[model samples]
Structure formats: structure tokens, C-alpha cells
Target: MKKNGEMAVRRPDDMHLHVRQGELMKVVVPQTAAVFKRAIIMPNILPPVTSAERLERYRERVVAAAGSASGFEPLMTFKIIPGLSPDVVQELKQAGALAGKLYPEGATTNSEDGVSDVQTIYPVLEEMQRNDIVLSIHGEDPDVFSLDREEAFLPTLRQFSRDFPDLRIVLEHLSSAAAVQAVAELPNVWGTITLHHLELTLDDLLGGELQPHYFCKPIVKRPSDRAAIQRAALSGSPKYFFGSDSAPHPVDRKHAPTARAGIFSAPVAYQGLLRFFGEHDALERIEGFTAVYGADFYGVPKNGDELVVRRQDWTAPDEVGGLVPYHAGEVFPYTVIPGWK
Candidate 1:
């Protein structure tokens, strides 16, 4: 993959990404489109994309924002709410939804309407299993302490694997070693590792200063957790793959008294990942981690085109599309060669 100071790999598919609705979406969608050929769009926007009509409309808006030339595919998902009709699952599949996101109530931003009890959505999960629709969960138990939430939710995850044995579940943005091991042990279950989680720790978020932007739901964990996640990603296991979780919030909202939980990583993700994989001597395996495994798991075709990165220094943008990006102002040794397919 690497030769003559350049690396080439399949254009990645971001398995988990959040491009919010309306004006904000317009600003961020293209950043992801630039580096990723497709992205699984999150559905937890205000009012949420719960119905078929809403999902179609949201997909349309995302496509429009991505524009005709980006060749970006927004793999849409619907929000999973309690009491959801099983019949509605068929409609969502017909509506082109590839998955359903389960956000525990009050777990993250705009998730106040999420499912509180895991069992309450069993009917919906049953339908999805029969229909082969993927179940993407936020994977945090809201009642627990911030650091313990992900660990606390493992029991529920285990129960789901036992109850709905055939369901394809994605435990999103894993932050701990325990979670990494749990996902590895479960069959038909996969985990998405965020760039922030791979590169950061609780220390990066709070051990220095109040880094509100680094603050995220299932907040980044200890150094050992980061190591475990890094090990998993580098281990070449098909069960773990890349998902930027590139959430963008307005500057004011991120800097406010109650700062939001997200990191706008789309702009920096690919380049940072190139450096990380290369430095770790795992450059050859990056293609599968970013572009192959997730698509294969979803039963989609891998991207035929390639994305190139040059061994060139570039500074990470301080602010992108009015939102702060991950590793802002840091100089990266590798940079994506823009507009080169």
C-alpha cells in the first residue's frame, strides 16, 4: 500500500457518522464525503427519523447537501422507539433504511425520546432480525456514572445476543477494554471504534484542562482502554472497524455551561488514521479496517475506487464549517491527496 512515500487504499465507508439536519448538515456532509465514499447516517435528530417518510426526506436532504459530484452515499437509518409497530419495520426496509439506531433515553444529544427499557423494543428487534436489518445501539446505560455507563450496558447487550441470536448489532463508539472483549466474545456482534477513542483518553479530555470539545457520550476512557481499542483495531479482526462518530455542534453549544458530547472529526479523521496505522506498522491492514469489513458485515459491495494519502505535513484545521475539529491546530505528517480518486 505504501510506496514512494504515498499510500493508496479503498475509499472508506464510515460505518457510523452523524451529519445533523438542516444548515448544520449542509456544512458537515461534504467533509465526510471527501474522504469516505459512504456513511451510515445517524437518525437521532430533533423529532428523529422514525417513520419511512421522515427517513426518505432526511436522505434526500443529505444527498442534496453532499451534492451531485461528491458521489457520497448516505446509508440511512431510522430511530428505534418503544412501541414501534412491527409492520413499520417493513416500511423502513422499503424506504431504504439499512439499520435502526437505539438511543437509550437521555443518553446523548436529542435522545430524550429514546428507548428507556431494552425489552420494550423487543418486537421491533424481532422484526429487524427477520428482515435482516442491522441494529445499531448507543450502548450506554443512562442511570450509571458517565465512566461506568458503557460497562453497565454490557449485560443488556449480552441479553440481546441471547434473545435475538440472529440480529446484527453494532455497539457504537466503544470506550473500554471490557467492551472491546465483550464484543469480541459475542457472535454476530461488531463494534465501531472512533478516531477520538483510538487517540484519546480521559486524560486528554480532563487531565489537562476543560476540553469541552473532546467531551463525548460514553466519554473517552482510561489509557488502558485506549490501548485495548488500538490493539483491537490493529489486530485485523473483522469484528472491529472504523466509525468516526464525527458529530458537529455549533461553537456556542460546545462552549456553553452544559457542553455537548461530540467531536467534529470528519475533517481530520482520514489523515489522522493514516498516521496512526502507519506509525503502528499496520499500514497494509488499514484498507480492511476502513473500507472492507464494515461493508462486508452489512452485505454491501466494497468501494472500487481508491483514496490516496501523501507523506506530507499539514496542519489540522482549527475550525471547520463553523465547528471545531478533532486535533485542531495539530500538524499531521500525512495528508489525503484531495480530489484524487
Candidate 2:
């Protein structure tokens, strides 16, 4: 941080993000590349990216959408669905997938094809463990109550820690206190906490007349849970870092009779974080959470260049890509130097 209140830090990675296909991809992917040097692009598309071939095609679309944005790397991933051979795990690694996402069947949008039996994928997990690819788990059990979903998945994470002792795993967008403690105790496990989860609580979503933009899978838990996550994030623990999970759905789908589950924060995630961290006196911790830990966890080199964030006000647009972003219309107290995409 400079005397001018403009801080330059290494360009970061949105370790977990989703930019849906075709036109939507064109609209949103740039929002991420504009700020971060790299992003781990999620694979849960309409016909989810399940193979190296599909991943390659998706990468081309993402690259084209990114359009010569220098060094804006789209680190691709594959969805782990039923009947996917373990042999294909090696191919995914060779194809440059940083991780394989495990979404329990019926967990979230486009996850109907998610694996039902973790046992069925033991061979794949073993191969991933040997190959050193990270396993990104959705960390929810749909059969359980919404708020209890993440807690219920703790045992599964524990089992992975015990069985695949060498496999690196990331518990995505952890929303509960139990999850925070669970990840802390596990040696090979790391957690990615979203900007929305660190800021919003179940109260913000339902305490009033129901703010649909605050809704998301593994729905925001109690305030105590939010505090626990906040502690883990700002405490500067390398075990927990940022992954926006910046999912976007059209505005009609967001505020309809039944709203979709997601919070599109890519457009304002860094600015929002800048404000939140500054308010909490954790400004110095920002780069580590957003940039360093994730790349280190994935065995990639940290981004060399830097981005300057100044203490300037920039209000996010209410609508982006026909979608309502989380915290829509609110004024952020900080601004990225290069400005919004």
C-alpha cells in the first residue's frame, strides 16, 4: 500500500469460477480476465465438460471470448460424472485440468450427472491422487437439510483424507463453521471461501421480504457460520482462500417466481473484497488469499505482474449480461485501478 492509498499486488486467480457457454461466455469471461491473471473455469455446463476433448473445445471458446487478453489463463477442469473411467483421469491431467469437480447427484444446477457413489470413482480418485491433481468437491448432501448440507458432507471429506492420504482436495465455497474446522484439521485439504459467503448471511437473503440475488447453493448459513468463515479468511490462513463461485444467470431467471441459485460477483468481487478487507483492517492479507495460496495449492507459478487498487468509489451496475449481480446497486468503497471490464 502506498501513501496515496493505491496498493499494487500480484495479479490473482479466481481459483473457482463459472462462465457459461457461447454468448454468455463472451459476456462474462472477460469480467474475470480483466482483473485476474488466471481462473479455474468450472465444467458444469449444459452438457458438462466431461472429457479432455470437451475441455479442449471449451478452452477454445473461453480463449476466443477472452480474445488476446495477454496472460489471461483459463485453467480448465472436468466434471466427474458416473461411469467416467479412471484412465480418463490421466487424460484430464495431460489436457491441463487443474482439478476434477465432484458434485453429488442432484446437488446443484447442471449436476444431475454428478457421481452418486464415491466408491464407484475410487479408481479415478486413486489415479488423481497418484497424479497429484486436486479434487474439488461441492461439499453438500442434498438429502440433508439445506443449511446442514455442508456439515453432513464432513464425514465424506474425512473419509477422503483417510483413504487418499496423498490426494490434494479443495472444499469449494465452504458455508458452515463445521466445514471451517474440518478443513483446518485435515493436512491435504484446502478450502475456497467465496466473497459472497464471507459477506452475506442467511439473514440477508430471507430476513426481509426475500432478496433473490442472495440465494445460492449450499445456501448461506447462520451469522455465526458467516463469522467463522470470516475468521478463517481474514485470519490470513493459507489453508483457506478465495474462489468467487461467481455464477451468473439471466435476470428473468434470477427474480422470477422461483429464482435460480447463484451470486454473480466477478464484476465487483475484487472491489467488494477491497472494501471488506479494508474495513476489517485486513488489507495486507488480500493478495495471499486471492493470488498466492491457490496457485501454490495447484502447483502452478504465482502470477508475476501486479494490479493496483485505489481507494475510490465505484458502484456496480445492477444488471450485467441480463443478470442481476449480488449486491446490485450498492456502492463499493474501493476501485480496481484499470476499472471494470
Candidate 3:
């Protein structure tokens, strides 16, 4: 329990979460399920989930993992491809997909199946727009604009918005100031801020000693960019919300000779956010960023379920399921008090 007046709000959804398949899924799903009432599961997996059929199978696996965990049915999304017909979109909507994900080719982990040509996907995008479907984008260029991918991709995304004004678009994990500004200026664009990106920068991760933990795609930028994102997240704007982007890779992969790309914060997500907010003296806005904004933007009903974060501290397990490492170490100052048994 908290020392005095301290209390936790309800558990929040992870707008972005990656639970890999088979064994890894079995190992990781429970950790996230214990905290988040629902999560928008990423489709980038081995043989990425691009079809309705595959999405169902994945959903089944997730449901099975939820088992007796009440209020823990994590929602899944289809990473739609150009090859998928409009009818397919309608079919998946009928199947209960919360949204669809769009990844530009080779942008991040397991993204080879992503769209190679955005133009080719226009028909599918149009279909989604008509159906009131949301398109969650990876938001980066495939090549050339490496360092400035977010800026480079804006023109294309702007055109997409113009072509499909009604489509609900979410730009996943906005890293740079330019990205945040673009999302802020665009009417249809909602943006997510990842926990890792919220905390560190590219130079902090790679420049001095190669701190692999700070490495993430659309890689972190200058301090000025960080400041901008901090402002946007705290601004209480409905268009911006919290997404841990809690991707997990085996400790071997993260600490390897060639470290892999991802961060696993599922275990300590809420506490970390609380610490970050409290340090900034922005605790009151925590609910806006973590729960209200995300639920409102996604059209998900507010989960009446409440969770408390006691002042008592806890540390994330160094290794969960004997693979993925907890982001940083387990030095959190809060614990989620779940509503359900």
C-alpha cells in the first residue's frame, strides 16, 4: 500500500506490445496479462499475422494464455497487406480485430512481410477508411532517409491522410521532435510514445560505451527531440498516448556481441511510468497518458477495473521465462494492485 494518499489508477492498455509465438508467447503473455486489461498485440511475428485466418489462431493462443485471468483478453490486430481484399478487411472486422497494423518493409523486427510499396496498399487503406477501421503504422521509411525517416515519411503519410480522411491512423512510437510535431499538426494522426524512448537517447545508448539497451528503431534522437516528446506526452492531448512498445528479446540477443533491437518493460511498465511522471511532478497527468487518452483514441470503453500502485517498491525479474531481460534493472518504486482476483 502507499504511504498515505498514494494510490494507483486502473491498469492501462499497452497500445503496442509484442508477444512472440509458441514458446515465447507462452512465457511472456502472462506477465503482461497480469497488468494490462488489454493490449494491441503487434503482428510482426514469425510468418507475420497478415490474414484473418492467422489472426484467429493467434487470438486463440492469446485467449488460452489468459485462461482464468479475468479482464485479460488481449486484443489482436491484422497487419494488413495490399494483397488482402476489401472483403477480407470486412471479414476480419467481423472476427473482432481491434485494428490493423501497417509496417513499411524492413523497418523493424519481423517486418520483411511489411509493405514494399505504399501505393500498392492504397486500395486496402481505402477499404479500411470506409469501414471505420484503424490503421496502426510503424511510421518509418524503408531506406535512404535512415536518420530522418520520420520526416521523410510524413509527406507520404500526409498523402495517405488526404486520400483516406476517415481512416483512423496511429503513428507508432514517435521518437523524434519532427515526428511528434508532424503528428500534432496532422488532424488524423494519433501518436504513441514508447517507454524506452521516453527515457533515453541514441547517443546515450551508442556513443560512449555501446549501451545496447537504449537501442531501438527510428532510434532516439537529440535532447531537444526528447524534450519535445516529453512535452507532447504530458500535454494531455487525446492524439498522444502511452505505448510501452514492450518488445522482448532473449538476454543473449540483447547482450550479444551484436545486440538485438528491442526493450522488455512489461514487468515494470506502470511503475516506470509513475516514476517518470512523479519526477517531472506530472503525476496528475499520468492517467491521461496511460489510460484515458489511449482508450478514447482506440474507441475502447474505459475499463472500470482499477489497479493501485503502492509506494512499496519492487524489481522486475532479471530474466522472465529464462529468455527476455527486463528493461534496465528492477528498481521500480510501485506495484500494481489489480482489481480482479
Each prediction's TM-score versus the true structure: 0.98, 0.97, 0.94
Where model 1 places Cα greater than 4 Å from the true spot, the runs are 1-3
RMSD of each: 1.0, 1.5, 1.9
lDDT of 3 by residue, 218-269 (tens): 7888888888888888887888999888887877788788887787777777
Error of 2 at 218 (Å): 1.1
Give me candidate 1's TM-score against the actual structure. 0.98
Span of 10 residues, lowest total lDDT, candidate 1: 1-10
Q: Is candidate 1 or candidate 2 better by TM-score?
A: 1
Better structure of 1 and 2 per lDDT: 1
Better of 2 and 3 by TM-score: 2
Model 1 clash pairs are: none
**How many residue-pair clashes does candidate 1 contain?**
0
Query: What number of clashing residue pairs does each candidate have, in the order they appear?
Result: 0, 0, 0
Q: What's the CA RMSD of model 3 in angstroms?
A: 1.9
Candidate 2 residue 202 Cα shift, in angstroms, is: 0.8
Encode model 1's per-residue lDDT on 1-341: one tens digit a residue. 55688877799999999999888998999999988999999998888898999999999999999998889999999999877788899999999999999999999999888899787889999999999999999999989898899999999999999999999999999999999999999997899999999999898899989999899988999899999999999999999999999998999999999888899999999888888998998888899899999999888999987877888898998888778888899999888888646
Evaluate residue 75 in candidate 2 and report its C-alpha lDDT on the 0 to 100 scale.
92
lDDT-wise, the better of 1 and 3 is 1
At residue 22, candidate 3 shows an lDDT of 82
Judged by lDDT relative to the true structure, which candidate is superior, 2 or 3? 2
Return the clash pairs for model 2, or none: none
